[model samples]
Target: MRSVLVTGASGGIGAAVAHRFAAAGDRVAVHFVSNRAGAESTLRALPAEGHALVSGDLGDPEGARQIVDAAAAELGTIDVLVCNAGVAPSEENRHVIGDVSYEEWTSTFRRMVDVNLLGSANLAWAVASRLIERGAPGAIVNIGSRGAFRGEPEHPAYAASKAGLHALGQSLAVALAPHGITVTSVAPGFVATPRQEPKLDGPAGDALRAQSPFGRVGTAEEVAAAVFWLASPEAAWCSGSILDANGASHLRS
Candidate 1:
């Protein structure tokens, strides 16, 4: 079985991805920042054994490296790296240009960029370096967002950071391909995760669902499925691609 490391696996898309890999008989390293209980829940729900729990603050560059190193040590070697850890947009970090103070705007941008883009970049470097040294083929799947393309008016930092993440994956795909390692990313839109349930259950629910022709928001499992496939050997040729899991909610020209 392949050894996989899925960051932010405490819940939502990360947890789903962890389940998908484990269900395929692969060993998984479930990484969490502060939600050990949720991470344990995800670990216990896995179908197979050998799954482990790892924790670190992705905002710190060193923490990102530690997380990858710990996961690799636990799992023997990381065959797949799923960069799913990131700071999502919320009321606390909202920084609309005209509405928020200059301090809030700059701080929000820094935090989001640190975790969403730089953290993922550092993890990729750590994982890919090991794979190269061992002469092993591997895959890296980044969890991006449709907001990168569709625009997050109030959460511009999130959108910009994800956009950078997608670009980073593409660059790494080219750089790592010669080493037999593939990299790709997934951009999802309006997923109805537990954290987003309130939004989906509120008055804006209909508007969110109507973004896609399916008349429903995406699911964590669906996003996980895309990530799973993109990390498989069969999809190696699809490296550098940014798969849209938005159900045609926002088409890019």
Candidate 2:
């Protein structure tokens, strides 16, 4: 069985992705930051063996290294790396470009960019380098968002960071392809996770759902399914593709 390391595996899409891989009988390393309890909860949801909990704040380069190191040591080797941890600032903190405060905008952008883009890049670099050195092919799946393609109002920073992630995936795919490593991205739109429940309950949510061809919000599992497939050996030839799981919302544009 291949060993996979899933970052942000404590909740939402990350948790679902971890469970999906574990259920498929892969050795899983569920990585969390300040969510030991949540990580353990995800672990409990998985099968009895071939799974482990790893913790680190990946916002720091050193912490990202530590996470990959621990996962590789525990799982023998990192065959799949899922960079799924991300953050979206609250509406209160979000502001249009000209209206946003310098402090709030800079800090919020830093948090999102550092974790979503830099953290993923760090882990990708570490895992890809190891795979190259060991002469083994591997896969890296980055969890991006449909917002990366369509601009996000009042959340330019978050959108930009995710866009950067998409670009990073493509770059890694090309650079590592010769080494037999594949990198792909999954972009989900309006997924129905606990973090999105509040927004989905109101009229705004209803309007957003109506825009989708499916007429409803997508599920974390649905998004995870795409990630699972992208990381699978079957998708080895599908590297650098950004699979859109947005229920055709982007089609309307």
Candidate 3:
């Protein structure tokens, strides 16, 4: 069975991706930042027996390297990697132009870019190195966001970060293809995850659902399924693709 490393697996789409891989009979490395309990919960949910839990602050370059190394040491080299950890936009990090202080804007952008873009890039580098050294084929799937194609008026940093992530995947796809490693990304729209339950239950629920023609937002499982397929050997030809899982919320040319 393949050894899979899914970052941010403490919850949400990350946890879902771990579950999907486990269901396929793969050993999973559930990586989290500070949510040990959540990571344990993810580990317990895995149907397979060889799953592991790893934690690190991917925003730090050193920590990012350690996370991948720890997973590989525990699981005997990761065959698949899902870069899903990110600093999502929320009430705390929301900073609109003309409504926020200078310090707030700069700090917000820094955190978003560090965690969402650079962190993923670092993880990819570490995993790709191991795959190359082993002369083995592998896959790296990035968890991007629909906001990259559309826009985030209230959280420009989040949008810019995701946009950079998508571009990063495209570039790496070309660089890694020659090494028999595939790289792809999934840009999901609004998804129904635990962290988003409040928004779905609040008055804005209808508005959010209305964003999609399906009369609902997407789900973590849907994104996970796409990630699983993209990471599969059969999908190697689909590398560099940025599959949109936005439930028709926004369409781009």
Cα deviation of 140 in candidate 3 (Å)?
0.3
**What total of clashing residue pairs does each candidate reach?**
0, 0, 0
RMSD of 3: 0.6
Model 3 pairs whose backbones collide: none
In order, the Cα lDDT scores of the candidates are 0.96, 0.90, 0.96
lDDT of 1 by residue, 1-253 (tens): 9999999999999999999999999999999999999999999999969989999999999999999899988999999999999999999898998899998889999999999999999999999999999999999999999999989998999999999999999999999999999999999998989999999999999999999999999999999999999999999999999999998999998
lDDT of 2 by residue, 121-218 (tens): 99999999899999999999999988898888878888899999999999999999999999999988888888788888976898979879779989
TM-score of each candidate structure, all chains considered together: 0.99, 0.96, 0.99
lDDT over C-alpha atoms for residue 233 of model 3: 88
Q: Judge candidate 2 against the unseen true structure and give its global Cα lDDT, from 0 to 1.
A: 0.90
